[model samples]
Target: MTPRADPLTVDVVDLIGTVVVRFHEEYEHAAAEHSLTGAQARLLSLLAVEPLPMRRLAQRLKCEPSNVTGIVDRLESRGLVERRPDPDDRRVKLAAPTAEGARTAERLRASLDFAREPLGQLTVAERTLLKQLLQRMLGITPEPSQNPEQEEKKGGKGEKKREQGE
Candidate 1:
């Protein structure tokens, strides 16, 4: 019989941590020419993809909504973002990237391709295998989690709801 790999021998968490650090380092360098902070670049990119409510954006960014307001304000001052009234609820504001903001995000992304070159060294087959293996081991592809607004929309069980009398 073939020898079994020891489950305890694998340090997958450390490997993932290293990968994230390296990726961010490369990203910081790539976007340096744009003079945008990492957070700014990330926020711009998010808004470019789709307009999101302030609360939702804050949640996605893992920060307080008030903090998101400041970010949005800065971006707006730079003419990179614009806010509009939500269709369903005028009281709610939706944030979207302007054309200039989209362009900035695209430029940042193009520059960031330098970070992918190392991955290109792997053969297509190896890359595919690695991706599949990692996915299988993790049971999910890593990505950002839902924002508080999204949780609210999902009817968060733990969230308090106002009673009619209260």
Candidate 2:
């Protein structure tokens, strides 16, 4: 049988901590280049893909909706983002990036050199494995995959616990 890994050590914890800290530092630096806070840049990045409800953004950012509102308000004033009614649910508003916001987000992403270089060196499969491992480490289950090999990699539970809010 394969031997189980030992429990996490302080050194390992510190290494992960350092990685998180450095990643944020890099992100914050990129955000500052665009005159945006890291949080604003993050929300803009998400919107660049697709508009999301404030509640959803708040959940993803692990912050209060009021905080998201304030950020969105500033972005809106700058003509970077616009609040639109969700067609599926009129009661909810979706925060979408304006054309300028999309470009800004793209630029901010491109400027994150620290992440870009190392991640670029990895193959697509290696990147996917890294993502899945990170998700599990952070208690965020990786999404269920169609490939049988991937399903086997899930090992259990992760596939069933896909819903973030739940």
Candidate 3:
């Protein structure tokens, strides 16, 4: 058997786990209200920002390519998403959300206000501090503010771009 952890460490880990579980439950309820399974809802959300190829979707969802194909097939049947030939490679197919899909995904997001109720309890300063603390815990170093237009012009290399195969 493993040795017992410190009481403070155990409490912190338990709290984080509980918060994550609650958030997932809330998200599931929001998805169900739209008549979407969790996977389908997640796929729609992923495609909302930009079209992605099947392989890329699998990578993002941490699932097998075959699994993504099945999910895409179902979403396509619902007319929420469509498969298009990639511009860079005709052989590759990209999954893109249709107009209806985008609206549905937006609605699903709007319904999930789980964080709003609790986070609203904190003052602005407290919220800011909480965000900073969370970021630090995730090992993300805060960057100095930069001009949004400049960042856009630079193409934000740090952000993932959809590649032909990926």
Candidate 4:
């Protein structure tokens, strides 16, 4: 049987999935000693900032509120997070990290005990550039072309070459 050649284009969704999987693998490896699932550890980190409404957390995690309930239950079982009544609204439930959870976050961040170490190899300039590019790709900024003139200033040569199939 003859092999089919791969098309020149790559799907954006496939690229995103690949990156997510690679990041999760690295994160799991780094946090393996903590006896905490990656999702639990991530939730603990999120709660360390301030108590957040459970619904808001679920939105942030891009999961159903019920799914977050299970994630939070596991974290709560580990004493890494606590639930409290929202002061602003009695109907709302707030989630916050415990003191032990804060300590764990500090330990994890201070020990460089996560996938972030791979990013450390990049220089500050490279990191900044990567962040900017990713932000643009994610549509986080209204102005997608930070240097729009650069392409036009190339004097139409690029378009001509493309038209001629160079």
Candidate 5:
């Protein structure tokens, strides 16, 4: 006889699986409407922030460099992204989004509202709590912001004095 599976474990797995599948489907549909494959859209989104070396992009995307090269090749063909030599290291190639790519990425974000509708149902406090819980679950430490307003609110006033043993 097979060992019985725990009901709670099964429920948790099902819930997570459902959410992942739904989100991916919604994103893929949005990408298709924009004439982009899901992988290409993701690559454009990643490059929008800043140019990155192919190796770094592969590491972040959790894929091989060869896979990234193929995606980049297609994007480049569309005049959405470009490959440039890294300033500090000429030997390394960096991928950067063109003006059109940035606009496309912005449009993609505006069109994909899958999470917004559901998350809007929660109260502000609930949303904050949920964000904290998710961050904790992912083992991420929230970083202090460089903005003066945020720094002041986070008790930056006494931080220096305390550090100096005042």
Candidate 6:
């Protein structure tokens, strides 16, 4: 049989799946080391970026708000998280990390120690594109940001075009 120019989607998906599974397993181990469940660890990681309302977090975590409440309650009991009224909307409570929680989160993030050096070679636009593509493949929405195409159009068209030409 003649070789195809592009790889089959199934093959690509299988490879991506393998990578995701491996990453998840490592994350779970790291979470366990910190005395947290994978779900709880994930919640902490999300909050580390910024405080978010329980409902919003549930939406991002793809779980019911009630589940987020329980998780938050547990974290609160451990002094890993705290609920504070949203300054803009007093009715809604945002989950913010405590100092200890932030420290734990930093430790957890540092422990991953995975192969990230290769990513250093990618240009900013290329890295953004890679991140967006992975998020798409994982069925996650890409966060709002200027895309690589937009970046190219803005000031790097010639540079990108030259790279593409090579």
Model 3 residue runs over 4 Å out of place are 1-4, 139-143, 146-166
The digit string of per-residue lDDT tens for model 4 on 30-104 reads: 456577777766777788878888888888878898988998888888888889999899888899888888888
| Ten contiguous residues with the weakest lDDT in model 6 | 113-122
List model 1 lDDT by residue over 23-102, tens digit each: 88877776567877777777888888899998888888888988889988988999999999998999988999999999
Displacement of residue 79 (Cα, Å) in model 2 is 0.6
**lDDT order of candidates, top first:** 6, 2, 3, 5, 1, 4
Reference-based TM-score of each model: 0.69, 0.75, 0.77, 0.66, 0.79, 0.72
lDDT of candidate 2 vs native? 0.85
**Overall lDDT per candidate, in order of appearance:** 0.75, 0.85, 0.84, 0.71, 0.83, 0.85
For every candidate, C-alpha RMSD to the true structure in Å: 16.3, 10.2, 10.5, 10.3, 8.8, 6.5
Q: Which sequence of candidate numbers ranks them by TM-score, best first?
A: 5, 3, 2, 6, 1, 4
> What number of clashing residue pairs does each candidate have, in the order they appear?
0, 0, 0, 0, 0, 0
Candidate 2: Cα lDDT at 149: 54
Worst 10 residues of 5 by lDDT: 144-153
lDDT of 3 by residue, 1-166 (tens): 9989999999999998998999899989999999998889999999999999999999999999999999999989999999999999999999999999999999998898888778655544455567667888999875554334344346533232322223
Q: Which ten residues in a row have the lowest lDDT in candidate 4?
A: 148-157
Which should have the higher TM-score, number 2 or number 3? Answer: 3
Candidate 5 lDDT by residue in tens digits, 59-135 = 98899999999999999999999999999999999999999999999999888888877765554445456666677
Model 5: residues >4 Å from true position, as ranges? 1-9, 144-166
